[model samples]
Target: MFRRLKTSQIVVDVIVAVGFFVIAWPIETITVTGALGFEYRLGSLGSVLAGLVIAGLFSGALALRRLSPALALVIAWVGALAQMSLGRPPGFADVAIFGVLYATAAYGSRTVYWAGFASALVGALVITVYLTAGPMYAGGLSWQTLPLALVMLVAAAFALGLSWTIGALVRTAVRARENRDAQQRAEAETAAEQERVRIARDMHDVVAHSLAVVIAQADGARYAAAADPAVAAGALATISTTARSALADVRLLLGQLRHRQGDGPQPTIADLEELYAQVRTAGVQLRVDVDPAAQGEPPAAVQLAVYRILQEALTNALRHGAPGGAVDVRLAWLPDHVDVEVRNPVEPGAPAPARVGHGVIGMRERAQLAGGGLDATEEAAVFTVRARLPIGDPA
Candidate 1:
């Protein structure tokens, strides 16, 4: 695919090209009279036609410097050859060579980038030989001429090498910046994805668990309304309270999803009491065993994970366990970690469900996020979910 050109850079290059043409419209050439002696000469202003053709080619290269640096380099060579052929001296127009070489290294593709380095080395040698050729023709070079030739070669090499090196450095810096930008974008995307999954899991736990209790209470209230009005009324109250709480929790989750502000504290281990009360109110016998910790409470991440996992497991028990069946919940807080286990008897008549439900998946994800592991299984008519979350562990 063709990359778009930078209009501003093209404009600047054109302006610079115009400046070179204005300064060197009539080109000149250098000539040496003696080989060994220090007798040098400069050619008179060359023919206007030769100057126009040579300078125009170099200016064209300058204009195309950033637009197509490889082509610009070719044009530069063509201009250099034309000046040598026309016996013209280097002039202000040759100034475009520095910009063209820099662009080739900074903007060109890999092949052209290396070609720029080749041009720097070979062009220096060509300049050194061409400038001294006249002196050699007049009087063959001797030991006296060696130092002058060496100086010319070293000077040419230094100027050209410096320009290419600066451009190469720019290329490296640009690539590094691009890599950093790409990495930041990827990290941001990953964080957003994780946030989405968390919201979905929380929503599922709240809605599914709350609705299951509301349904169980509603059914029981309908059957008991004739036998005991007070019992039916209490069931209705529980339903109302459960529904309001669920609505509030759902709203809280929604608020978190909608905006960054108003993010309240999440449920922790302490909230398990309210959860158990709700399960009992739904006509399920919940037996909870708590093994307190000597190391105080765990990290917030661990508490949140424990609460959510237990909530989900009990929610499953309420939804799929034997009608009025008993559930056993255990929590043991150790120095380094907290362990959670929930066990409920299954109804013999109830069909086997998919081994892992969405609730179970959400529980597993919560445990893993808190730097923990979870296992949920059904064996011998009993469903169990166990989790071990590390305290203050890096996630």
Candidate 2:
């Protein structure tokens, strides 16, 4: 409840209050005259005491203007009426009403703002009536009275209305700035979340596919060691290479949390040859066919999607297909899109892979995110995965 007070605002209020207190009596006695041409002249100590008391009330109210504008406005108007009752002319303390009006518009609630505005209208009417009907113009209203009343009304309204308008403009500007800041914060949060999901999917693809290759190579080396030492050594080499690539990719993904940097190198369509060789070493006879004329280079994002989709499909074949079954990979690059198809014969007795495995889901998500489509199907003892990814302007 005890928040820090604004030092600058307090300093300004104090200066205004002290200035009003010091000048209220002197300025009236020296320069200002009554509406009836009567000049201020101090007759006794009581008049001085009354003047000081009224100034104190006005100054005190001014000090709390920003803290509670409605309360300050009430106190200031009361002080103004007191000065008028004593036939005293308007003093410098009257300026405090404008500041109070500004505070109401800037910080006060809806009721307070409307109350302050009503006070302005009522105060103007009261001042005009007091000048024309009070002892200052006791001879009765004359031709000059209407103009004088109009001047008073306009002056009062202008002073109070102008301050309120300025405060309202400031309030509008502040709210706009706050809204802009909130929108930017929300956008930043959304982008960060998307990045996190992308990284998670990449990790799933890398780890799952690598582990499948490592298992296949290990199993093959165990069986081939007695038959041929060279074949076992080559299998061990493939396992080591696959494991190192997976480790490097994982490290790069983890580093993203600590620093913002390029993702180094990502596998693309050009690396499919290496992928095919790795699958061949894993004991799967792989056939890859590419239409040379259709090899127009695709965008990097599409290339990455294509590479990951193909990788995931082949990994599944290695894990679930018959040990000696043949796998076929076909690539067709078109003007606006690229199509990839991988097919393998399902093992006779082994159950077909799940229609929505985690790996398949990851592939589908990747393809769709790249503005593409993917399909996986099992029919006639064969499992097939196909994807079509948009490129260039289509992306």
Candidate 3:
């Protein structure tokens, strides 16, 4: 929020510099008039305006205060040196000193921030020394003036220090707020990416599982129509049922894509029964066993994780297991976590599939996202996928 392009800042500073020039002109003129006239009934209006114009020119560096604080500081120093050379008393144009010092701390680079701090201390000392010794040079110097010099020094130091401190505090606040805003933006982007990944994974699971079953049933029907028409008829029925369910799942997923987060339907633990039945009708002997020990139902997020893992695992088995293989599904519920394992038979000495796919990766990611773990391995002609999911609420 504190940041601004230098191009725009330059224009703003120019306008501010003009404002300062206008205000200082009148104040400097009034001070000159009151000093020369009220004190000694002397001095012309034309002379007062001429001297004030020169002082106002020195303060013109305010135009670059924010855009280039170091440059502004340099210009301010030039003005101060000129005023001291002319032995001029304090005037409204001197306000640029505080303005420049404040800009150095609030808007400058590292070098300039510290440089402004040093200038504040040094400038106060210079002012006190110049004012104190001016009387000495005028032939009226004495020990009685030392206390007044000390008072002037203290007051000048306090004013300069206060300006720098306020600028430093503003700088710190702006930086802290920007950092917090950046962190929030990063977190939001991460959430959006994760949601996209999750949707892709779900679409893969639903379509892959349904199509695998349909293909198996269609192939079985193609070969068995003449010898046993009843077997062919049953296969077609299973294919129909699986396709309709897949179509509905796809429609729901598409709807989710069009809506805001949390507006879509989520699968839970109870959906596993229909999955097993679909696989069984594809001519694979599917067996399921569940041992319940937890007192209450799991959170929806954990159940969704468990469901997706099993769905993908069963899909893999149905597509790659040995022909007419018997798949074993087991679920063991614990107090704080649930365990799921799917085992399907393959050829006795067959090698692993030639190319690895995202099925295993997706399942592993799902488990980990739920604050748990998963493993998929093939051993002794049996492909096994095991996963554990925590029953805790979703983050």
Give every collision pair in model 3. none
TM for every model, in the order presented, reads 0.90, 0.83, 0.87
The regions of model 1 sitting more than 4 angstroms off are 1-3, 26-46, 134-140, 260-263, 293-295, 349-356
Q: What would the per-residue lDDT of candidate 3 be over residues 104-215, giving only the tens digit for each residue?
A: 8998888899999999999999888777675223423358877877898999999998898888998899899999999999999998788788889999999999999999
lDDT of model 2, residue 152: 78
Instruction: Find the 10 residues in a row with the least total lDDT in model 3.
Output: 33-42
Residue 74 in candidate 2, Cα distance off native in Å:
4.1
Worst 10 residues of 2 by lDDT: 26-35
Clashing pairs in 2: none
RMSD of each: 3.1, 3.5, 3.7
lDDT of 2 by residue, 289-345 (tens): 886435556788888998899888998998888768899999888777888899999
lDDT of 1 by residue, 71-119 (tens): 9999999999887776555667788898889988888899889999999
**Highest-lDDT candidate:** 1
lDDT of each: 0.82, 0.80, 0.80
Off by over 4 Å in 2: 1-54, 85-87, 134-144, 292-296, 347-357, 393-395
The candidate maximizing TM-score is 1
* Cα lDDT, model 1, residue 248: 94
Candidate 3 ranges beyond 4 A from true positions? 1-12, 30-55, 135-142, 225-237, 349-355, 393-395
